[model samples]
Target: MALTIGIIGLPQSGKTTLFNSLTKAGAPIGGYATSTVQANLAVVQVPDTRVDALADIFQPQKKTYTTVEFVDVAGMGQASQAAKEKREGLSPEFLGHIRNADALAIVLRTFANDNVTHVYNTIDPNRDLDSLNAELAMTDLATVEKRIERTKKAAKSGDKKYVQEMEFLQRLQETLNELGLASDVEISAQDRVVTDELFLLTLKPRMYVLNTSEDMLGEANEVLAKIEKGEQVVPESLKGELKGIAQVALRARAEGAQVAAVSAKLEAELTELPEEEANEYLEALGLPQLGAERVIQVGYRLLNLITFLTAGEDEVRAWTVTRGAKAPEAAGKIHTDIEKGFIRAEVTHFNDFIECGSFAAATKKGVQRLEGRDYEIKDGDIAHFRFNKGK
Candidate 1:
């Protein structure tokens, strides 16, 4: 599956710059707050060393890597007034793009820009976070209310099904009112079907992107370390710029949300350079990897996604699926014929195959396992589908 994530933040947060860096796609960079009015979408390859290693073994004529799609959304607010408007915040266009996304990445600007204005006039990341959260929460609230109304009407028709659904929505309404996320609220599997179409924003998994200024890239990353350690640090002069990101990172870390920090301006500029020149710059900056790459990896984790390999002389390909996918379903990702005419899967862990030098070597070492259709595929498994497709 091509996983999708929605990118949202206040204007001038370097969201578009970061998007460009991640996907290697050029998106218009706004000079000031509110310059971006339309959404930019890009499909980026998920870089994996495993794919490279598998390619070495199979020496495929064509190699395919899995990708993630990101959509950069404009109009989310960090201002108090805009935050107030967020209760009814989502526009038709925004909701249409976001509701279908598998996950969300909330960008927080920890960078300072005199020329690039802050939406709130002053930066306070906590308040900005409140703005983003309130906006998302309010949107989810509206979705639930509309459902409650529908369920109530359905309940009035003497159908007992709607009665249970009404109570379920009411419970959800109460929980959401208490600032609880819809995903955290308890609901039956049956009731989940009723709310399936709702696509409550808060129910989607989230990643906190901390966008830092050039000078503070290291400091911003240090803040990430502290946040991971459960320690909070707010820069007195840059609270608005830094704290919201810190809090969001802290919250994400504590609540199992994926988190990363990067200087979008720096990363974007780096992306503009040649690969060798970029690495030289990164080395001079004492960085391990581009912040954009970190963001992509974290976003991938937030979606609860895993990669599996299909290695052969013809193709060395990466396939993405939700974590618990079984053999047939994973085969379905490649082609229906493979899944339908399913036989056993000859599998070896990617790491093991890499260590053993080749697939034949892995078989010689007795590391290859023949798994039936009922087998659950794990991430990074180098699989050869032994199917009887009657060509």
Candidate 2:
């Protein structure tokens, strides 16, 4: 199954714009009141220069890249004043869309556009982030409280496991009530089993996406310099905007969340152009790659996943696996039969294989090794498994 990351933010924060840029789906972009009522889902191939290089070397009939699924959820916000008193939690439909997501990309608007109205009627990324976090925390607190109550009832039966679970749930409830993230609390290996079942939003891996103006797409460093030197002294007209983005970066660093700045509008436009034209445009703008690509890569890594490569005359493909996955588990990604056969695997590092120019050459150079099923796969490993047909 493809790993999924959900895009979430306030209305008009560019969540849909980022989704369109990343997936090239051409989803509609609209004002604050025009939020998408339904989630938009797309699977996108992860771009890897190494994959392209290997494909060139092998001249394979087919080349495949690892993919990630992006779900652009509608903007979430406070209930209307009339309904605020009765609003207990997030809408059930919104929870359904986000519950299964492996990670989240919280898009925060930093650019000032008079034409595009902010949900809060102001341009403050930090305030927007806090607002969203509060809602997510409230949702998690509700989940934890319900679990605590149920676990308490079960513990009355004197089951030791239930008692322990009750204690854990209470602790989680306390943390959530304090407005702390579920991910921030440490839990035992055994307790993790229960936490995973809750599917708490605050527990998922998250990153910040700072949506800036097109003029600031590749000028983060320059923008920062101006901000640090004082906006008053800096002649740039967008100094205030740059300062807003810098504040978000600082906040993300303090909170240990990954953050990236992107001009979603620019990237969406670039995606509409042909590949060659896009590359040329990026070159003209002095950008190494699209901001959307960086966001995808960051989101992929945040999920704690790594890619291993397979190269051959027939096919060259990149496969995704958890960071510490063993050889058999990695094989299971391709086929259960391969994993069930349970044999040794021939492994070579990508760089070593590329240097040797061939598997035989790598073997001759003593870089290729026969690894058992217990061997843990590393990122960039080129693997060939040898397994018995009759298992």
Candidate 3:
């Protein structure tokens, strides 16, 4: 199954705009709260230069890129937060959409517009982030409390495992009550089995997306570059408009979260243009790529996923697997039967293959290696599995 990430933020935060840019779905964007009552889901191919380069080299009949599903969930307050304050927790319909998401992209608005309304009547990304975080934490706290009660009952049967589970749940409850994420509570490897089943929203890997004004895009990129390069100085002129961005960055650093800034309105407009025109427009704007694309790539990596390639005259495709996945497991992503009849994988690094210009030349240079089922797949590996039909 394609990994999914849910897009969430306050009303008028440009989440739908980002979704439109990422998926090119052109979903309606407005101030109406009911507009997003039903989640908007789209699967988008991950943009990879490596995939294009491989397809060029192989002259393949087909080229496939790994895909990720983005679900534009409705603004938070419509159901979840209202229910949480009543001590009832998230509604089933709302929970169902996001419960299975592999990660989350929290959209925080840093732009100021007199026409577009902010739910809180102000543009403060940090405040918006904290408000959303509280709601998610509350929803998770309710879930953890319910599980604690159940585990307490189960412990009465004298199962030591239940007792351990009860202790873990209580710890989770305490952390959530303290406004901490379920992820903040460190647990043993065995304990993860129990916690992973909870599907706690706060525990999911998350990225912060700052939706900035078109005029601020360049400055936003500059701020991000400075942060990335570990520069300590900021220009006096930009400090005012970038305060929200700085606040969000500090919060992200405190929690070890990823952050990206984008002009969602501009990106949505760019999506309406042809690819070549869009590239020229982006170049004119001094952007390497769309912010929506950066968010998708960052969220993909946040899930601890890596892409491996399969190249041949027939096809050149990118496959997604969790980091540290073994050869047979990666093959299983293609077909279970292939994994069931596993033999060995012939592998070459993408860079090596590009340098050598062909498989035969790579083998001549000893760059291609034969790997067993136990071999851990690495990113950029170009692999071909040889498996028997009758195993």
**Top TM-score hit:** 3
Task: Give the top-scoring candidate (lDDT).
Answer: 3
Candidate 1 lDDT by residue in tens digits, 5-75: 88888778778888888887898776433233467899988888887877777789999998889888775
**What local distance difference test score does each model get?**
0.79, 0.83, 0.85
* Residue pairs of candidate 1 with colliding backbone atoms: 123-240, 124-240, 125-240, 125-244, 126-244
Whole-model lDDT, candidate 2? 0.83
Worst window of 10 by summed lDDT in candidate 3:
232-241
lDDT of 3 at 335: 86
- Model 2 over residues 1-391: C-alpha lDDT tens digits? 8889999899889889999999989887764321235788999999988899999998999999988899988787844554334434566677888899998999999888988989889998888988788778777888888788888888999999999898888888888777778877889997999988999999888888889888776676455434444453322334666766777666665566777778888889899899999999988877778887888778867777889988898999999999999999998888899999969989999999989999999999999999997899999999998888898
A best-first ranking of the candidates according to their lDDT comes to 3, 2, 1
To one decimal, what is the Cα RMSD in angstroms of model 2 from the true structure?
A: 3.8
TM-score of 2: 0.90
Give residue 328's lDDT in candidate 2 (0 to 100).
Answer: 92
User: Can you write out model 3's per-residue Cα lDDT over 121-171, one digit (the tens) per residue?
Assistant: 988888888888877887798888878888898999989999888888888
The reply for model 3, stretches above 4 Å from the true place, is 31-37, 78-84, 233-238
